[model samples]
Target: MKTKKMGIQKHYYLMMLPGMLWLLLFSIVPMFGIIMAFQDYNPGQGILHSEWIGLENFRYLFQLDDSKQVIVNTLIISIGKIILNLIVPLIFALLLNEVRSLRYKKFVQTVVFVPHFLSWVIMATIVIGIFGYNGVVNTIAGWFGGQPRLFMADPSIFRELLIGTDVWKEFGYNAVIFLAALTSVNPNLYEAAAIDGANRWQSMWHITLPELTPTIVLLGVLALGNILNAGFDQVYNLYNPLVYSTGDILDTWIYRLGLQNLQFSLATAAGLLKSAVSFILITVSYVLAYKFADYRIF
Candidate 1:
């Protein structure tokens, strides 16, 4: 029996070999470049021969005005997404759960979920068209004698746009977990609540919400790990100089710094900082998930 079990496990390990190699080539190998953060990296000289300047890049990174603004923008956008993604999905799942017609429920779920599968490349174009100076929104506003606002270019509302669109795109996918959690809820609880003269809202409030609490807490805690990841693909595709004040995130700033401005050291420092913070947050989030939600990877 032990020999048979070992043979089965060997096949599983063999299956994982390709993924492990991919990770090594892409993720693990590129991590060696993190040393550039502490060096005046010269492409011609290569990483090994680059001039070492310990902590200078980090000090300069902290002193920059753009760094502070980008950090603030990232936090605001990510936090907004996290909060809305949690609440909106939970509410949507609850509302969908109450629907009597199975056909309507499945159709609504399918319609909302389609956006999640679409890449940000496609979504950003659609968003830009909708919010452009002469797009559908402005065309509609023109009829009401209102000025055509440049929604995409406006700095004041740019963050809101990013957050709102992200929530809209992801809430349907996020709600799936909530819907699955709802199924595990004892139907007898609802039956009992109905016998006690409870309405739909009352039953949901008393029974459904309580049953789904663990899932909600688990997802919310897990989301803390991504607090710094403010959707690079979405921001990179949608943002411009006009909206930089509000829309620029760490990833976008790093791209401009390194690739555009040729400030490799500074960009690497910024990236390293983000990676370190993300690692810490991810560790903390997993610990919290284990404690609060009884989640365990092993």
Candidate 2:
């Protein structure tokens, strides 16, 4: 028995060797910089000679006005995106499921999903063009006797702009996941409801949505873990200093501070804190998933 188990373990190691090596090179080695979050990192002194400040980086981060705004902007943008992303896609998927025309359904799905494949950098250009001072959207607003507000440039509107643009980009792709889950729900359930004289609305509310609850909860759990992400590419490309009050996220903040401004320790600490929070949230979610939902990840 022991020999057979040893052979199985040897085979597993052989299968995992390359993947483990890749993780070591890409993940573990880079993770060493997490230590810098505890140090007063300096380019001249390097990682080894850097002074260890322990929790000072965290203390400094909390004390700064910019950091407070940064955290607030991140949470608002992320939470808003989370709500819009889920509600819009799920609603879309539900509505699309009602369409009986295969050709039209496929065409709409294809068109909507296309944006997800495009890079945010590319989409940002399109967004700028549409929402610019004299772009198509602004021109349309002129017909309504309204002035063109700079959605991307205005601090007051930047959070909404981020949420709106992100929803536009990824909602269709998100719908595909919900659609797949929707497909798995038993067709007989719908048929039985119809035979029992249930209205389409009743079937949707009582049967369809209830069947979708587990998948929704699973996705929600995943989204909740990243309540701090707030999207770097979207914010970085779309934001100007005029809108930084509402548009700055932890990711964008870290990139600008760590890479561009070279505030290594401070930036790393911000990222580290986000990571710590995300880790705790994900851990708690998984525990709940197992305890309450009886779901196992592996």
Candidate 3:
């Protein structure tokens, strides 16, 4: 019996071998390049021979004029998206779950999920057309005798645009998880609530919402890892010079520094800072998940 169990465990280990190897090769190995954060990295000299300047790059990063603005923009946009994304999806999932027609529910889910699969490049053009001076939005405004606003170019509105568009794009896919959580809720609980004179809203508030709390906490905590990630592709594709003041984020800043400005060392330092923050957030998230949600990811 012991030998049979050992053999079964060996098979399980074998099944995990490929994924483990891939993670080690792509994820763990590349982490060694974090050394560039502390060095004045030179391509010609390469990483090994690069001049070591411990914390200098980080110091320079903090001293930059736009650093504070960029961090503020990143946090505001990301947190707004995070909060909205969770709320929108959970509400959407609950509403969809209430629909009696399975076909209509699936159709709505499909329509919403379609946007998630669309690349940001494609969506950017669509957004531009809708928000442009001569576009649908402005044309509609003109009908109401309002001014044609430059949405993509306005610093004041750009962050909101980023957040709104991101939430619209991702909420459907996010709701899928919530929908799945809804399925795990026992039908008997609803029946019991209904027997006690609970309405739909009452049942949802008293039973369904409580049942979904663990799932919500788990997803919310996991999302904290992205606190510093303010959608690089979406923002990069949509933003221009006019909006950079309020829309520029850590990822975009890193891209400009490394690719455009050739300040590779500074960019790496910024990237390192982001990764460090994300790691801490994820760690805290895991701890919270365990404590509040009674969930363990690892």
Please write out the lDDT profile of model 1 over residues 151-222, one tens digit for every residue: 988999999999999998999999999999988889999999999999998998999999999899999999
Clashes of 3: 0
TM-score of each predicted structure versus truth: 0.94, 0.91, 0.89
Please provide, for model 3 over 66-172, each residue's C-alpha lDDT reduced to its tens digit, 9 standing for 90 to 100: 99999999999999999999999999988898899999987898799999999999999999999987989999999999999988899999999999999889999
Task: Flag regions of model 1 displaced more than 4 Å.
Answer: 1-17
Off by over 4 Å in 2: 1-14, 143-146
Candidate 2 or 3, higher lDDT? 3
Deviation in Å, model 1, residue 139 alpha carbon: 0.3
TM-score of candidate 1 against the unseen true structure? 0.94
Name the lDDT of candidate 1. 0.95
lDDT of each: 0.95, 0.89, 0.92
Question: Per-residue lDDT for 121 in model 1?
Answer: 97
**What is candidate 2's lDDT per residue for 103-217, written digit by digit as tens?**
9998998899899999989999999999888887898999999888776677887788889999999999999888998889999999999999999999999998998888788
